[model samples]
Target: MKFGYLSISINFARQIPMLNPTTGEIALFHALLDLKNIDMNFPSTTGKKKTWADGFDPTSATLQLYSGLSANGIVKAREKLKALGFIDFKSRGRRKSTIYKLLDLGSDKSAFNSSDNSVDISSDISGDNSSDNSSDNSVTLIKTKQDKTNTNNTSEKSQATPHEQKKKFSADSVEYRLAMYLFGKIKQNNPQHKDLTESQEQKWADHIRLMIERDNRTPQQIKNMIDWSQADSFWRQNILSTAKLRKQYDTMAPKANSEWQTQQPRKRVYE
Candidate 1:
């Protein structure tokens, strides 16, 4: 459930347009195309919380409410987008939440310009039009036609390819869902910890991937790892740190025994 770098990156690459559509593999894609930045610690307004219309996805906003960045509804959305290769998030943990940086979409800039005439297709279509008295006019017309054709080609190429549009994975994927579950538990246990940055999430995903590789485990194994990680103090402490666990302990101390029954009290008897 806890994502490491590799797992997060792979999931992100799968979600974004940076992977090969045909093979469902990561390609020469960059994360910047979908996001420019991430800001987890943005101050919340006094009134009602923002909604998807306020630039956050509705589903993710709900998830964020239960996650580390509960104050700002954009946290979960940002994390999901980053994991999907849409943005890059940054954080140091001192603030209430993390920060995110979205990368610009990798649009072909020249396609947006109206003046580029690199492709000369008119000459190909008009063989004898150049020989007429009004050859100049004919040439101009041909150039315009060529420009249109070039523009169309550019537009098609700029659009997402079929492979890119394919949906290979979702939050329901065993790995991703588990990660979300773990994040929710962590947030529940330690509400004070700042949201996990993109890098940190990726690192966690990578750690999970490494464990998978080391154990040659199946997806089921990974799921079990997540379950164990959430329940096991040693594993969580090893991955997160004793300091973090201590914080969780402090937060849960009041209700801890009642909730978990770590120990059983002696039975009371009245004679």
Candidate 2:
């Protein structure tokens, strides 16, 4: 699908780490951000009720097309962003488009503020506020995302406190067990693996819960896939996180099944 140019604020670009969004969340947020820009340029004629004054109501299909996320991924990302206070929404009724508003990241700099909201490719963003810093404005947020990825291993838990590790959940719960199972396999591969913080554990459990309740994968199947992937020479390193496993589940499933078939000894022909 063709996409028009996107204008992202330089200040907002720098605050991404503070947002700490997942890949899907970031993608959906950018799509919405772009839509907000478009709306500011040519707003809806339906009258700006306070309920949706600064909001943009895009169809789910439009979001999927623009964000490159599946319908389910968009739903999950929307919920996550709402919880994070980066965005808010109002339901318009069943089968109708939902109105979504991007909240100010923090401080006085509202992303879509009426006074400063402009779509000039040169002056707004990706160009320059002044002549000399044109190249600096040219630095894409993609590079910043890449830099965050590279540094994740060192800084992933630096933001979490030691007390957060003391947060508890039901040990007998299937979600927690599945999360711990994945964490155990990770620790087997690397003995020094750190324990999950509260949020990490909750996120991992939620992914596993969705695998069961949403994806229709049984607990046994998930366990089998976990074992198979962790034993494989290549996937062992790559499938270190529950989110990664969930993202790659379909691709890994067939290979895992084939490997399982090969590893099983053939039945004897005769007694």
Candidate 3:
């Protein structure tokens, strides 16, 4: 994709048609919003000591469906936006979504603000001189995103207390309680799991949050899995964590059913 001295805004979404060349530029701006913090992933642009996830972009299939554009058109448009520094893109391998970041868009700002609820294209970019800063603009784009990434990390640290530990779920929350309960069971079964370190607690807490927030598993479903997994001797050995529970849910259910069905029928007390 050619990186150019083009400045495009989201409000340009209105005056342009999808088939028009300008529409892809505007639509590419919207795609950045999808790379937000989902429960499953959080990708950051830069950080050496601390590992942070980069933002996630929706698949080309999804972008095409939403924007009424062909797949190639979406890729071409996305590349154009990347060229301009209005967006940042990071590939996370084939299985995971690509990450995107909307740069901080500093006061030398080229990004369009849709929150104002206006669609006026700025006169500055409307002319032929917009390309004058292409080289500088491209460099500024990644630098700003990297700066924003660092700032966000700093802000997170400032806001958190020792008690917070980046664990946003309350101690009283069902997810937290579920994590504790599961951990307690794991401890009961294995002598090695007895002492609960802070790291272990935090790790399971993340998995619990993933199950509740990302997987959309209901509290009742989690409760059922806990009960059933513990009751079955085989699963008591296998289903050790919430992460494992979610990963094995489909397989576990059928096995549980089959375990019950093939068991020796108890002498009927009263059917």
The top-ranked prediction according to TM-score is: 2
* Model 1 lDDT tens row, 1-271: 1222223333443333333222111211112211211111132365543211122122333333333244343444445554544445555464433433333233222212212222111121112332331322211110001133455432332223455333232433443344444564454334444666654454344433333333233333233233335456754544352123222332333343243233333321100
In angstroms, the error of model 3 at 150 is 32
Flag the better candidate by lDDT, 2 or 3.
2
Native-vs-model 3 lDDT? 0.46
What is the lDDT of every predicted structure here?
A: 0.33, 0.57, 0.46
The sequence of per-residue lDDT tens digits that candidate 3 reaches over residues 31-72 is: 444223121122234532111122345776776765667877
Tens digit of lDDT per residue, candidate 2, span 152-212?
A: 3423432224554444545545566667767766664564567678778777777776666
- Model 3 steric clash total: 6
For candidate 1, what is the lDDT? 0.33
RMSD of each: 26.2, 18.8, 22.9
Off by over 4 Å in 1: 1-175, 241-271
Pairs of residues clashing in candidate 3: 42-53, 43-53, 43-54, 44-53, 44-54, 55-99
At residue 187, candidate 3 shows an lDDT of: 47
lDDT of 1 at 33: 16
